[model samples]
Target: MDRIANIHTLTKRLIVMTAISLLVFSVIFGISYFFNGRLMMTWLGFVCGIIGGFVSIQQRIKNVSDEELTLLTNSWFQILLVPIFGGVFSLVLYCIFLAGIISGNMFPNFYIPKPSGSVPDANFMIELFTKTYPLTGQDFAKFLFWSFVAGFSERFVPQIVNNVADKSSEKVNPSDR
Candidate 1:
């Protein structure tokens, strides 16, 4: 009974901490979006991916055994790695989009604007934000959706990579016809 109560307490702590972490990252992303718009897509993708990871973990927690739940929630090392994994997968997805492997009403290209001063002026900062932001409103939503999907489904990017590899191999070693 005591152990079960402790597990429940730990689980609640995990949920609260993850929520706080998400809020913190959202604030960071908002602040950095314009200042570092050069990597805006990457940043957005990472944040979305982190959200996906958190959501996925939460869903799994519901269906898991108490032992598994305790292990998953208590393992800070594993929890910390979630964001890194999310970022990496999101980055790979961004690269794929940039490479024209995935195409839609999306802008895969970006240009960094030059600042007038060491600290960019407002117009220059606006220019920087406008130039580097690759998507319009709807398209950005799409990117966020896909990036979140990628993070939620661990197999998503790996499947894409495998598919690309298969295609590359076929191209390199064409069968005699």
Candidate 2:
């Protein structure tokens, strides 16, 4: 009976901590967004961070088995499918059916001018990252900063909250009894 009660108490505490963490996380991300440029990809990173944190909390409480973690990690392969499909799209564009739509709009411009019928320009490879749109220099920096903060908060906050809860319960429950 005591063990069950403790389990229930822990669950409740985790729930409350998760909610409060989410609120704080939102406030921090919102402040960043307010101060930064209004780019859609940067905004998406914040949303993804909160969602991933929520998922991690749920999985932690459920005491997900190793098999479950493997499955969850494997699910990231779905993201790789985008690049696979993109390559096919690029092929179609090269075939002239898409007429440079995929290459021009989606990917970095890789126009490497040949040096008098020699190899393509050496700077072409370097320019790929230096010239990406939508995720230009500033947006990439802000995205990295916010992602670091979110990852740190998600990994550490719950442990800290749970430790505090455990200590408080031990001190108060013993006194009350």
Candidate 3:
């Protein structure tokens, strides 16, 4: 009876936490959209991450074995970390995709500004960042999909990161090879 009650409390906490998180993200994303179109991709990715977190938590509590649940020492703080990790992982994966290391299809497409010799001004840096940051419409959905996947699969991004690290190691130390 105690175990069941504890489980209900945890589930309710997660639901409330996730709802608050979604509202916050949406508000921020809405404000950011007007200032910089490029931020939309990043914003959407984080939202997807939060959703993934919520889904992951719901799924976890549903099937958590009695023995597994019993042996674990846990708290609301611990459970809340899943969505937090989800959002962070989504951002990291976005960077990896932006770097074009994953796949040609996964790379974010963007508008290429024509080279112009313009005098520096207050707007120059802002304009440059705005141009460089946003993804073109063509690949927007693709990136969004991958970002959600990254948040959902806890193992996937870590595996890719490790693989990237391994590949990078060779470039740093030729003597080892």
Candidate 4:
């Protein structure tokens, strides 16, 4: 009985998180395409948002204590932060790409040419979102690799940072006299 209830709760959490993630991904992709006129950021945001939302939900399920289960049951909204953070990270990477900080060695032909002197309007942005870019086999492979990195990095980097912070804090505070 208890096991069935736990499973039921997990199922609900997963459904809520996935729905919220889809909404977030769509909105972020639309906004990113509007501002950047690029599909890369939109793709990255969608991938990262979905992956981050699921990963965070999994973490919550694993870490939930009996006392915390009631709190977690009603906290489906908290999972939205994971995707938002991931999308922001993707945007930062897109900015770095625009700034020429990263080269397209693996994807030399991945560039999508933008129209000159024509500012993108809502229709243009919508069209851009609906349109698909042509990618060679190699370019597609590189994109998949980068997308996975972007999706995973959102969760991975924070764990690395927290681990480093914990180590440094322990060294500074020396628990044992």
lDDT of candidates 1 onward, in order: 0.69, 0.41, 0.71, 0.56
Choose the strongest candidate by TM-score: 3
| Backbone clash total, candidate 2 | 0
Please provide, for model 2 over 1-177, each residue's C-alpha lDDT reduced to its tens digit, 9 standing for 90 to 100.
343443454445446644765586577667755765333332334444444444344446347455544443345343223223323322222222112322333232222223443554656533432232233555444433333334334433234346656877898898765
Task: In model 2, state the lDDT of residue 106.
Answer: 27
Off by over 4 Å in 1: 1-14, 30-39, 65-67, 105-130
Question: On a 0 to 100 scale, what is the lDDT of residue 60 in model 4?
Answer: 57
Which candidate leads in lDDT? 3
**How close is every model to the real structure, measured as TM-score?**
0.71, 0.29, 0.74, 0.50
TM-score (C-alpha) between model 4 and the true structure: 0.50
Q: Please say which candidate is ahead in lDDT: 1 or 4.
A: 1
Rank the candidate models, highest lDDT first.
3, 1, 4, 2
Residue-by-residue lDDT tens digits, candidate 4, 16-108: 767766786677778867987655445654565456546655655656776555554556565455555665555444433334445667631
Off by over 4 Å in 4: 1-8, 23-44, 64-70, 103-109, 112-135, 155-177
User: For all the candidates, what are their Cα RMSDs to the real structure?
Assistant: 6.1, 21.8, 3.8, 8.7
How many backbone overlaps does candidate 1 show?
A: 0
Pairs that collide in candidate 2 are: none
